[model samples]
Target: MDGRRPEWRACVLSGAVFAVCMAGTTLPTPLYPLYQDKFGFSELTVTVVYALYAFAVIGVLLLVGNASDAVGRRPVLLCGLGLAALSAVCFLCATGLGWLYAGRLLSGLSAGLFTGAATAYVMELAPEGGASRATFVATAANMGGLGCGPLLSGLLAQYAAWPLYLPFITHIALVAVSAAVLLRLAETVRERQPLRTVRPQRPALPPQVRAVFGPAATASFVGFALFGVFTSVSPAFLTESLHVDDHAVSGLIVALAFFSSTAGQLAVGRVGVRHSLPLGCAGLLAGLALLAGALRWDQMSLLIASALVGGVGQGLAFRGALADVAAASPGHRRAAVISTLFVVAYTGISVPVIGVGLLTGPIGLEGAGLVFIGCMAALVVTAAVYLLRRPEPARV
Candidate 1:
């Protein structure tokens, strides 16, 4: 019992560190408006800046996503923390747009490193037969941390001094404390390897995984795309159309989607993975409809509803997809297959938001948002149909 207690403690401690790193990634969500005002840039610039982080994350996932498996987890995670600190520093010293770009890029790298590695570490830290509960811990830390980012920054930006500087500064301190905690935890990987032996992981799927991967990947894509739109553009919508200027409210609205996603993920345990995907699609479709109504009528209530419902859908679909895909892949190539799914997910986050940014100038934010919703709705409906028609096999 004493031995098991320490393992659980380490598991929880690792999850806390995971949360801290992820919180840094979304820390700037509510601050984008302030950045636009300060830098005299257009809305397109904000979307581009946000997309840059996704792009960087994709790059790292492709390039070195499996580094921790080769080198020790502690080394890779420490490097991620270093990148996060640099990102914070860049934000603190922002003289121009360049600083924001650099900061976001570094933040993306930090997230990329943490996403796969930290998750594996947390799971490994759990006592034997604790895989199921550990999975929830890793996922909650991820979505919960992302949710906390904007909430924390929004409150600090609104109520506290240094709207710009204080949030990142606080994050830096958290990063430091997290690093110390990480150092104290024993390394989980039994066989250590040099960084030079690590190779960039290419996205690959075994022949058997292709069938399930399609619907799974599609659901994952639409789910992340919805988040991309929410995190990148919802605040602008609130400020421009609703004329709601409070940073805390804006942060809470955006954070709602992520927090709701966490809730959706928790439901997967009860809903069963097979049923979760199609049900999640229904939720996403409803959420998109709500967003459309919000956009058309400029109703704040509808917008909030959209965030909550869509977030839950994203959570359910993503977690279900992940669970299904992981079960199907061969153990030898699991990491590579999972990385490919993430590549698709992050692409969803990047491409659609950039498209919205491009269309914003010609059609206005509302029109662009409507267009995005329509496209995503069609995609989610298709995925739902596929899932319903050919339910994912218990094992593909």
Candidate 2:
């Protein structure tokens, strides 16, 4: 085990690298309004652009989710960073809507590769008896890095000159540093195969895992859907409805939701697996209600509260869903099973956000938002009820 300390260090370093790569995905969150102004596009177009990223992520997850396992983590991560660099370049040179769509799609590819590989890599790097703590580190890096992206870009864009170009330029530098850091980390795969060995991954359910998958997936779906709406449209809402136009303020608000989610995920260990799902569902339901109230009242305070409370609920439910599904999955198929759950979670992020975007033309932002809140609330309530009826799974 003496040799494992170095692996642990390598794992932590890799997780940090993963965080930096993922951060690039949201670097444009606070700047969406700026893009809208430059391109003269509607809010619906903004959401469509955002949904494109989710679509790319899902596509990669379905087609090559296990590429890292087969070909080696380092290569996959390096490729992801390369794609991320290209994405930054696209944004830096963006001239039209197509550029934004291409950039988002590239960002999605980077995230898709990192998500599963980085999580497993971190756990593998941990010392004996350190799995649980390592899980937090990996997850925190994932969500926390996502939170930091907009915060960093927004602040830079607001204070520094070249609001559009500077953010991607900064991301390029960070990605370079992250790539260098990743090169020094040890490869977790023992007998890595050739790239040709990679194949499309199919999502399937084993009977044993089906019982927990339902409620856990439900909560995860609603939770991610909440996040989807917040990240995709909240900045627009802040500018249009609340008359708060500061880019930094908008980024900070969105960051708060993701950061709060990290905090909420941390609570799951104490909450226990059984209670985490139901309790998280409760938080999601409350968050949806708060969001609906915000839309109805047109209050900035309500938006902030919805972000904080709803984000916490999302974090709780998301982590719980992952844990529940992972525990129930057979060892051999664990990665595949987990990928399926993520597909479900990410589906939540895409479909509903697009629905809102589609509805924006007919009903307006407030009306569309209210409709989203109602649907998500119903889903969360359903999940909570299911949790209540079924016996809680045995905790690890």
Could you give the C-alpha RMSD of every candidate to the true structure, in order shown? 1.7, 1.9
Give candidate 2's TM-score: 0.95
List TM-scores for all candidates, in order.
0.96, 0.95
Task: For candidate 2, give the lDDT.
Answer: 0.84
**Candidate 1 Cα RMSD after full superposition onto the native fold (Å):** 1.7
For residues 50-97, could you state the per-residue lDDT of candidate 2 as single tens digits? 989888888888998878778877888899999999999999989999
Clashes of 1: 0
Clashes of each: 0, 0
Total clashes for model 2: 0
Using lDDT as the measure, the top candidate is: 1
| lDDT of model number 1 | 0.89
Candidate 1 C-alpha lDDT tens digits along 111-222: 8888878877887898998866677787778888999999999999999999999999999999999999999999988877888988987777788788789998999889
